[model samples]
Target: MRPRVLMVGSAPEERGGIGTVTTLLLRHGSRHADIRMVVTHREGPAAMRLRLWLSGTARVAAALVRGQVDVVHAHVSERGSVVRKGLLVLLAKAFRVPVVLHCHGAEFADWYRGLPGAVRRGIAWTFRRADLLVVLGSSWRNRYVELLGVLGDRVVAFGNPIELPASVAKPAGLKVVFLGRFGDRKGSAAVLRAVAGLPVELVMAGDGEVAATRALARELGVPAEIRDWLSFEERDELLASAHVFVLPSRDEGLPMALLEAMGHGLVPVVSPVGSIGDVVQDGENGLLVPPADAAAIRQALASLLADDGMRARLAKAARSTVEPFAIESYLDELAARWRSLTG
Candidate 1:
């Protein structure tokens, strides 16, 4: 019989990592078994498949009465979602379902890094009951084990899953792409500053920071082109035609855009933050520089543009490196883990 599963979250219904991962698991869970979702807000393409609205805790109690819910995958972000997530985890346990906590923030540790011992203990205690805690990087694992006192066995290092194209990258013009929200943490302004006076076209996608990025571009006298958030198909077109994908983020959780670019064989130049080290591999798949360092970012872009063969080689290697972290494997691993928990 297929195991019933519940994925709870704040914007669990949104079209981001939390939604995407939950969707992937549900899709693959059926291959070996069966699973369902319980989302606060049903978001993303997968919602169309097994869409659920947040019936809240009342639903968890209601579902338990109906039958066994094998597992609860709680996806949490840093900004005030923890209270809701923690409450749900407690509820899942009461419902007799095993719990897996997957964090979406890159600076998970840093958020509590400077807190006092009592405060940190108080915070860590909230998640101590999880059967499993999923972090994308080894560093994050270490942080949870060492600082948070989560057992080593409970932590799993998983990367952001991307669906890579089988085709190799074709030669394209000097296209520099920045795909993310136009926000301060993303350093959209820095991207504009770096590309100013440079003889290259920039494709800036997403909202929020568009006005600021464009303003910076105009003030710096750079030829920056702004586009709305690209759809999956449009993103493919852009990555396929682009020469470089640059994400100068002050924060990240292995940005999906970076992996998607590598899937299409575009070299990445990003800040050395989050699980970026899990994929960037510096000088290997892509180049990593200090956060907010526009001068260094610009230099790296110039260096890659000057050497097409080098960029192509890295992109090829990147594509290969990311194959194991593909969506199919991600689903399989997650489903297997969920089954193991239920059993």
Candidate 2:
């Protein structure tokens, strides 16, 4: 029999990494497990957000009482996400359900370290109690073990999966794409500065500080095409038509945009922060730049823009790098994890 798993996280309709991951799991994971979604967070006023959390928690409690849930898989980020999902972990433990805490925060370590000692201990207690903690890479796994005192055996690394495109037509001209939030953490301003006089045309899309991003682009005279968050089809179309993808983030947790862009055979010029170094080998499959360094970003972008042979070689290699991260392989591995917990 399939294990009954409650996949908890933000509303799948939201546009972000966790929402995208959760949506993928629900759409594809049903064949391997009886997966049910429990949205613990969403974008809205404070009252609406609180109501969603309360109702989601009530559903979980009810399911536990009725013996309907076999496992609780909670996707968590920093700050409020940690506190919210930590409570779910404790509740699941009280009901004797195996819990899998998936950490997706790009700056989780930084945020955790800045907390008061008592608050840190409370968070640590929540992590240590979980049956397993899922992280994006080996580095994150090591960090959890060393910093949070989570048992090494309890942590597992799983890269975010993507649907590898069968073929992507070579796009013409020097067009570059950037898909992520527009904020300091994502280095949106730095991206504008880097591309300011470059020969490449830039397309920037995503939520958060959109007005500020537009203002910065104008101030820099970048002439970049800045847009709001895109739908899946729009994103894919943009990826297919772009020659290069750049994300100079200060931190990341294996961004889905990076993987998807690479899968579409767009050469990546990204920062070597978070789990990006694990996926992108500098000068091999992609180019790595220092976070928040516009000069370095410009240098990397200039190198790729000037050399077609190098760009073609790197784009082909970039697609190859993400082939193993196809959704089928990820789903198979996740199914195995669920079985082990329920067995």
Candidate 3:
């Protein structure tokens, strides 16, 4: 019989990369192993979300008591996610099941630094006790080790994976695409300011602060095409029509949008945070800008717009860079790793 793995994270219906990764794992992993998901988080108001978590926690505890699970793979983010997963990790320990703590938050290091010393120590203790600690990149791996004193051997840096898009012809206009939350942390305001009055068509896709973003665009007199909450097909259509893709996030754990854009052969102009620098070589596959710098973003955008040859070369290289992150290869490796851990 295949080893039964208990995967803990957000609900399948939840948005963002964490949910995307979770859904992909459960889908592909079922072919190779017995994988069950216990959602400890969901999308709703505070009280509703809390109730779901409490109910989910009870279900997980019941599963442990049944003695059917061989491994507990917990996907964790920062702040409240960390606290919730910390409890799940302890619960898995009590049941004597091997645990994998997968850290996906890009702002975790900064968040950890801001916590009280006691809370920091507690977090470190929780991390150290896990059988395996999975990070999204080498940068994050180094931070976790330094912050938690985790053994180097215990941590693994695995990049996120995606299905590549079919080769599409480049569109006519110099279109720029931004697909993510329109929030301060995502640096949407800076993108608005930078792309303002530029001779490029900027397509801002996704939810959060939509009204604010529209207001900013009006204030700047920048006629950006803002699409709130696009479907997968809609997002792909926008990417296909783009010569450049820009996401100037303050933090990220290897953004799926950037990877998807690169896969669609859109040249990237993103902030160098999280695992982005590891994937995007400056002046090679993509251009990197400092976070929250509207002027710098403008300069980069202007440069890309001015140079057609540079954009074409970078676009070719950008697509090649993400080949290793293909979903099939990732799932094969993930399954093998799980087997080794469970055995």
Candidate 4:
């Protein structure tokens, strides 16, 4: 029988990568294994909030008690760990089944980055107890080891998977997109600054604390398109017409936007953070610039605008780079890893 995995994470309205990853896992996971998605928070239409909670947590937990679940994957950190995720982990421990902790935040390091004394020791202890700890890149393996040294052997670096678009998007040179939340870490402000004075039109496709992003665009006099939210179809249309994809996040855990843009064949100009090394390969697949450096971003953008060949080559590579992130490959590797761990 296929192993039954109970995957848990935020709902769709949260606008985070974990949600995307979880959705992709379930959509593909069914092919190889029995999967139940336990969404732990509210998203989308307000009226359905209560319904999702009962169906997701209550109905799912009852199934677990009846021996329906074999593995429970917690898609959040241990501290901010919600009730649904925490309960599932405790249950897995009691049942003597394996549990997977997938950490996607840049804050994973911050949890014990430079700590001292007994508290740091406690944090290390919790990490040690994790059956399997998953992270974005091998570069961070040692850092995780520093804190969870005892579980070092159990931890693995698995790059986040993304869906490839049906075909490479044809750039009209009339549009550009920045598809993450507005904030210092995301550095949407920097993307705005980099595109300043350029003839190309721009759209900002998320919402956050920065009312100033709009003001900043106005001050710099760039024609701005701002949307509070976008449907999946609308987002695809934006990606289709966009000439370039720029993610100026100061820190990232392999931003799905960057990967999806690559899937859609939009060249990326991104900061080298998390597992981005797998996605952006400098002048080869896409552009890479120092995060928070508007000048570097501008220069990369200018180069792409001037050279059609460079843009086309990078776009082609971007689409191909995401071939590994397809739904099928993710499910195959995940099932193999689960069997390996449990065997």
Best by lDDT: 2
TM-score of each: 0.89, 0.97, 0.95, 0.88
- The model with the greatest TM-score is 2
lDDT of each: 0.76, 0.91, 0.87, 0.75
Q: Report the poorest 10 consecutive residues by lDDT, candidate 3.
A: 162-171
lDDT of 1 by residue, 179-247 (tens): 888877888887888887777778888767677777777788887788777666787888888777888
Estimate candidate 2's alpha-carbon lDDT, on a 0 to 1 scale: 0.91
* Each prediction's number of clashing residue pairs: 5, 0, 0, 0
Point out where model 1 deviates above 4 Å.
10-15, 26-29, 41-54, 114-119
Clashing pairs in 1: 13-41, 13-42, 13-43, 14-43, 182-209
Q: Which portions of model 4 show Cα errors greater than 4 Å? A: 42-64, 82-88, 114-116, 150-152
Candidate 1, RMSD to the unseen true structure = 3.9
List the candidate 3 regions with Cα displacement exceeding 4 Å.
Answer: none
After superposition on all C-alphas, the RMSD of every candidate to the true structure, in Å, is 3.9, 1.1, 1.6, 3.3
List model 4 lDDT by residue over 1-343, tens digit each: 5788877777644666887788788767787788877776655565676567556667556766788777777787434443345555665676677788787776666655556767667656555656887787776666677756756688787778776777754746646788988878888888888888887778888768457788888888878887765666787888888878888776677777887778888888888886787567898999888887889988988898899999899989888888887877877887887776567
Better of 1 and 3 by TM-score: 3
Could you tell me the C-alpha RMSD of candidate 3 in Å?
A: 1.6
- As for TM-score, the candidate ahead, 2 or 3, is 2
* Candidate 2 residue pairs in clash (backbone atoms < 3 Å): none
